[model samples]
Structures are given as C-alpha cells and as structure tokens.
Target: MVPVLREAPELSLWLLRSPSPDSAAAARLAVRELDDAEVRRAALFVRPADRVQYLSAHIALRRILAATTGCPPESLRLGREPGPLLSPRTSRPVLRHPPVPVHFSLSHSHGLILIGTAASAVGVDVQRTPTIEAVRVVGPALHPAEWRELLALPEPWRPAAFAQLWTRKEAYLKGLGTGLVRRPAMDYLGLGTDADAPPGPPGWIVRDVLVGPHHAAAAALAVAVEPRITLRTLPVACLYDGDAGLPLSAAPLLALRRRGSWTLRWSLLERDPPG
Candidate 1:
C-alpha cells in the first residue's frame, strides 16, 4: 500500500515529465488508478500524445491527492464547479468530498504537467514557448497594455514574454474559477521584472516557475500573505512501480526509492522574489 500523508502543506507544486514512447507499458500501468470518467475522457482524445498527456496528468493528480487525504486514489471523487462569480457554465476542478480543506489545480502542455495543492484555492499552468505566429494571433486578445508590451519587445523575446504573461493570467483566472470563459483580456498582468507584481487581480499571488529552459510555468494561490512555495520534479520511472506514483510517508521529507538508479528528489528549483 502507498503511504499516506499525515498533514497537507499550506502550498506545494509538483512537476512531472510525460513518459517517452518507449515506456508505453509502464505508463499504462501508472494510470490504472484513474476513475472511469477520467478514462473515458482520456479515450476521447484523438491523438495518442494527447491521450498519454491526459493519462499522465490525471494519475499524478490522483496520487498526490490520495497521499494527502489518505483516500484511495481510485475512490477519490473529482468534479467541476462553476468558475468565479459569474460564469455558470465554466468548469473548475474541485474535490467532491474532500477529507480536508484541499484545493488544487492541474495543467498539462506538450508533455509537461504541473499540479498545485494548497490549503486554499490554487491554480497552475505550464506551456511550451508559443510560436511567433501564435504570439501574433493571440496577442490582441490579451489586455491592451500587455499587447503593447509585447509589441515593444524584441522580435525574438516576444514568445517567452507572452508565455510568462499567459501562464500568470491563466493561473489567476483558474484560481478565480472563471478561466478564459470570463475573458483573459479583462485582467492586466504585466511584463515588468521588478520585485513588485504588476497590478491585476486582488487577493492572489502569482509567480513564474523555473522548469528548465523549454517551458514557462506559473502558479497562483489565494492568500493574504505569501507563503514559501515547494517545487519538485518526479522522475517518470517512479510511476513504473505501481499506480502509486510516489512511495511517500507522512514525514516532512518526501522521498521515493526504486530498485535501481531512479529516485524522487524534492529539490527547490529556485526561490523567486515574492510579488
């Protein structure tokens, strides 16, 4: 049996890289904990890559929540709630009958998945750097000031800049529960590099995350005061053992050991200055 968590952290973020094509059998075994609805949803994806990404993300989310809540991963009930205050039809993921006050969000893009858990509402997103054409196409849909800022950036820098802004915006919106259904252009999260965060939503802290050089990631939490953020990456091999992705206990230090070279390390990538 997988060890259960004695207490949930105030805030935490986990990053998992999707399995390579060669590890198909282990990847399939890793996601056996997903519920029937999740399995159906994953099957709906037309592309094989999309299906794998969905499977990888849901497995990680369930395993993490199971460890924290002491609930069987397959038995946990997850559902969508109406986002923010107004969008009645927008879907925001929430625990149906959580054993604790746990709020979480999940996002996956181009084989990278990010999951964030907190005592209060939290949202996270990861995205591959947008193409220059993508930036041009989506730029005008963002806040006017953000668009102008994108226009001002050097041609080569625009994709990264837009990606950072997009992740922050998505994270905040996801926390709000409104998502893009509420219109992303309504909020103005800026591109400034100073310590102070650019004016945007109130009562939430959004910050960029370092996930190596290929992807731009960010997480948002609804807190009056900023708390320390714990970031870690799980090697895909850990999932190869069983449906329990990380073999962890209630101890403060989260560790995973496999028979050979693969292991889990709770490394804090870097602490970015608080906004």
Candidate 2:
C-alpha cells in the first residue's frame, strides 16, 4: 500500500522485497509499468535474477512517486541523467514530458529494493553486510582517517562498521549526483566517537537506517536545515493488484494476499553545527 505523508516528509523511504520471475505473467506485469527505456535496460540483464531486481526496483519507484504526486504509476518517468529525477506531472503515461521538481534515489541489494524522496537533493544506498575479505580489500581506500578508526574496532565489529561507513559515503555521492566519479577518499564522514555523526562536509546530512539484520542502509540529503526522515514498507502486492490509483485512506486494505511482508525502519541524524 502507498504510504500517506501528512506534509512533504523531510524524507520518505520505501522498501520492497524483490519478486521472483518464475511466474511469467508476474514478470510481464512488472515491466508493463515501465517505459521503453526501462524495458530495454531490464532486458539487458544477462541473468533472470538481475533483471527481476531491476524491474522490481523501477516499478516500486514509480508506484511510490505516483502515490505521492497523485499521478498514475505509469505516468512518471524515472531517469539518471541528472541523478534519479522524476518528471511530467500527469495522471496517465505519456511519451513526451515536462520537468517536475522532485529529487529521489534508488538502490537494490540481495532481492531488496529501497527508494528515497525529498524536496531537496537526496541519495540513499543499501548493502548486504560485507565479508571480512571484502572489507579488508576496500578498507584502506576509504578516507584515511575513517579507515584507521575502522581498523581500531574489535575484529568482529569491523566488517559491519565498514559497511555502515561505505553506505554513508555512497549515499552522499549519489545525492551529489557525482557517483564514484567524485573520489570518496577525499571526504571524511567520521570515526570512533564520531561514527554516528555527520561528516566534515557542509550542506549535507547523512544518517544510518536499519533495513534488516543482514543489511545496512544510509541516506543523505543536501539541505540547509536538519530534517526528519520517515521510513515505510509498501507491499509488493499493492502494485500488482492495480491499486496505485487508490486514495490514501484505502491503503491499509490493499495489504492482502502478499507473498512477503515489508519491515519498516527509520533513523534520524541532525546536522552538526559549525565550530
């Protein structure tokens, strides 16, 4: 079901478990909501699992945007040209469009999809907790200070700590729309006593979100004031049931006959004042 935001939420997050593609009809239904470009991108995936993840994330993104903007799911156009922006405020899908002022980010990992939206530029990322080997390989390349603090953690806790830092940095970069093109090592997010604190950078707020026991997620927003973030899980059944057009009050009833359930998680990080 689509979550109803009382006001423009400082940040709104939606999470959905990816659906299996074994049901040919289900696979087709997922793609039907996507535009031609998205369809082509989904088809480019060599593995069925990869394709399913891509389609599910995109479809979930559209539905979430549709619900908030009071538009049809198929009408919104999702793109990465300027970093995951949506367009054309209309109720029905169209081939042409005009720009709408909205900022969003999307990430998928291990059959889970996450979408974040806000009035200001926003970025979010999700990752499965990393292995020791994986952390060992990438740890040194992180901002020098952050790496040192990570290594200082107890052996068993380092992997998860590293994942948390990585997600924060990635979310910041995604929010900036520079992706990895901007060197992550150039920025210090914090370490040791400051691990939960906002990074050195100005004008951005980052927070760690608890997605599940096995996964880590973080969100970053480019805004002047400290903002509150709300998280909600929309049932995958809501989209397939053709309920995207339903009013917000009817959302709860749409949570029927779902093969999986959604778990909502939230985190709030206020910006650190200047020295």
Candidate 3:
C-alpha cells in the first residue's frame, strides 16, 4: 500500500522506461487513462514514436499518482497555474481534485521518464547526454563558474560533466517556478571540483539522480534540509496486459516500508490483485 500523505517533505522518485515500438495497440489502450486534453496533446505529436512516448509517460504518471492518492487514474484532475505575462513555460502544474495536496513534477528525455512526488514543492529533469558539438554550443550559457569548470575538464569528459550540471541547473530552475526565465548563468551548481563553488540556491536541496551512463537526471526540493530520497523503477509492460491494451490488469504493487529512521525500502510485486 502507498504510504499516507504527510505534512513533512518526503521525496519519492520513479523512473519509467518507454514501451517498445511494436506495442502500438497497448499504447492506444493506455491512453484511456489520460484526460481529453492529454489525448489531444498526444495527437498533436507529428511522429508516431513521439505519440507513443507521450502516452506512456502520461499513463505511468497517472497510475503512479493514483497509487499514492488511492484515486482512479482518470479521476485525478490536472491543470496549470497561470504565469506572469501569460508565458506557458512559467506556468506550474497544479492538481485540484480529491483535495489531497501533493507537489509533483514530470520530465522525459529519449526513452526515460522521471516523476517526482513530495509533500512540499519539487522539480525534476532528465536528459540524454549530448554530443560534444552540442555541448560546445550550449555549455557557455551555464553559470560562469560552471563554464570554467567545464573548460577545465578533458575534451572526452565534457559531455557527461556538462549534462550533470545542466540537469542540476534545470531542476533548480523548475523548482523556483521560473524555468528558463531565470538565467542559467545566474546560479552556481558546479561539478564539485571547486572548493569555492556554492552548493545551490538557499532554502533548497539539489541532488543528482543516477539514470545510467546514457542519461543524466536530477531533483530539487523546496526545503531547508535534504530529505531521504526513495528511487523505484516502473516497467512499461506492467501498465497493461499483452496486446489487448486492457486497463492495468497487473498493477505495480509498490510496498513502501521504513526500515530505519530515514531509509525507505520499495518491494515491487509481480502482480497486484485488482484493487
């Protein structure tokens, strides 16, 4: 069973891999879990692969959120808060139904989707490591200190190092509710080699997420001190059954338990009896 929602910030991070290309029918069925707006948005994707990814990400997000809130995935109301000058990039995601307050953030890149949940405000970002050429073009836009650190690294090491700093900075920006409106060069989230480098902005905790060698990810929380972060993987096939594209026949039963004062252990069951 999902742990009861709490007042204090307890961070949970879930990583989901997108379904294979041949699972088109199953993808179509999973779209039922999304709202009309999400369905329309998926339709807007010109590439069939893009559409599949968008569907997989949304379905997994709703199912995971539903598990925690005990509400049907389709019943979770999702909307965006208006931003200054009506900029869509600045608009923050808000959930208004079931009256159970929880802060969540979603991010996807390539085949991986990351979702972060917490009692207090939170933000997350994931990125496929960029090529050396791409890194050279965008690396300078990061904080001057970060840029210098990147320059100091060997040529072969720059891509991964740059991705690490980039994800951290983006996570912080999303956490601040400013997105890219706040200049990336303004904050210092460095490669940790510099003894003088500042950790991050005040009143926030930023940490790197281990997504594997091909990708980099990070999460930030709006709290004075860092909280224990729990990481779990959700398999795409578990969202539905076979090629029938039926509704979550084998739901992921995440049994979360507190082993110590701060450790969270997640046991992923093979199948959950229909709730």
Candidate 4:
C-alpha cells in the first residue's frame, strides 16, 4: 500500500505538495518511463511554447511525489485527455502501472507557480495582481452579483476584485481537471469552504490564497463534498521573487522545474481573511 498519507474527507480529497519545481530534468526523467515513442510524438501537436510549459509543470508535480514516497518523479505520468480541455503532451505511466490514484494540477500567474495532486476532484487558480482600473473594466464581464459586489468596493479595494474572482475561477477549474479554456465562471455567493468562509458558492467550496504580493490564488473541492481548504505557503522563493519557478507541495500542490530543483519549506495555515 502507498499509505494513505492525507485524506480531506470534507473536500472528498487527498493531497500532495512539493516546494521545488524541477523544470530542467523533468522531461528526460519522465520520458524514460514511457515504453513507446507515441508520447513524445504527441508532443508535435502541442505548440513548442505550450509543450515546454506543460513539461515544466509536470516535472514539478512528479518531484512532489518523489519527495513524499521516495518514488521516481518521471515514473508518474500525465493523463492524456482528448477532450475539449486537451492537456499539454506528457507521460501517464502512473495510471497504468502501480495504480497510484494521484492526479495533478498546475497553475501559473506572473512568475508564481502552483501545482496540485489529489485523489478526488481538485482545482486551483493563480492570477497576477490587478489594478483598480482593470478591475473596473472587468467587473461587467463578471456575474451580475459579483459586478455589484466589486463595484461597491472602494477604489483601492477594487484591485482585489479581479484577483479574488480570478483565483476562484482558477481553483474551480483545477478541481474539475479542466483548464480555463472551458469557460467556467465564479459564483458570486461565497461557499463556506474554509469553515469561516463567507457564503459564496453553494454546491462548491473555495478559498483565497495570498502566496505572493502580486498574486491572488484559490483552490476548490469537487462536486462530491463542500471542501474546507487549509492554506499551505511553502518557502518557494519564486513566489516572493517572481522570477524563479520554485514549486510548492503539501496538500497536493507541487512545483517542478527543468533545471535546479528546490526542497521547499511550506506551512499549513488556517485563515479566515475577510473579503
């Protein structure tokens, strides 16, 4: 047995987190596990830009697994989806082999990076900080209730409007295992995802994260349960510096890079920040 290390029953979830995002070595390591070249051949479909992006994110997630179980990183593969939210080209050995019920998610906004892996439906979102003007412009595009809510905030507080909305959407998508291309929007009513959360989404649960100054983030539980997210802030220098792609792990989030790896120091904080 891999040992059930984490179980977030409330969210119907199990989580894994890693601080470093091993970008450089991930491609080489992951490919080695594949028995055929089709996985690599599939890479041709993904634009070079997107191909590289997916690889970096996958490697980071693999390393998170390695750190915990002492398993090989690339040995864990990315799931191939032919659906609308077709993911970046990568390996999926873990699903076939030893059956590691682990699934992963990746999100990046500005330079901050976030990745998540869980046994249940998981979602995450990261947004670059917005300006008050930008929030004003985006408010109309948002749901009517969100529009009124944000519009009512003071000028300086407006910047946070988009950030909060973006994070919630991102987190919701991550939980669904579908990227933003699916067009999922945020529910104005806050769900009590973190016990202290304001009434938001009724069916789903969400929590905002402050991993970096210029970043706003959120994560969600799937349709199964109303999740309560416990925030984890790892010592990912990339988060603070906005240059390094340093990853975060713990509670299902990991950071991987193709180059130098990071052994992150993260924290699990219970917070109820008033929105």
| lDDT tens readout by residue for model 1, 69-114 | 9998888999988765655666789989898889999999888888
- Residue pairs clashing in model 2 are none
lDDT of each residue in 135-166, candidate 4, tens digit only: 76666766565666665667787676568777
Write the residue-wise lDDT of candidate 2 on 134-175 in tens digits.
Answer: 999998888878887887789899888888888888888888
- Give each model's whole-structure lDDT: 0.74, 0.68, 0.74, 0.48
Which ten residues in a row are the worst by lDDT in model 1? 253-262
How do the candidates rank by TM-score, highest first?
Answer: 3, 1, 2, 4
TM-scores for all predictions = 0.81, 0.76, 0.82, 0.57
Best by lDDT: 3
Residues 1-275, model 3: lDDT tens digits? 99876544578887777765566444444666789999999899887777777887788778777877889888999898764436887888867764566888889888678888887788899999999999999988887778888989899999998888889888878877788887898899886676567666888888887766788988888887657677666666646633543344343424332322333222232322121
Output the lDDT of residue 233, model 3. 69
Model 4 bad stretches (over 4 Å): 1-56, 67-70, 82-98, 181-186, 189-203, 223-275
Error of 4 at 33 (Å): 9.2
Which portions of model 2 miss their true places by more than 4 Å? 1-9, 23-28, 82-100, 192-199, 241-275
In the predicted model 1, the residue pairs found to clash are: 83-177, 84-177
By lDDT, rank the candidates, best first. 3, 1, 2, 4
Count residue pairs with overlapping backbones in model 4.
34
Model 3 TM-score, all chains together: 0.82
lDDT (C-alpha) at residue 123 in model 4: 65
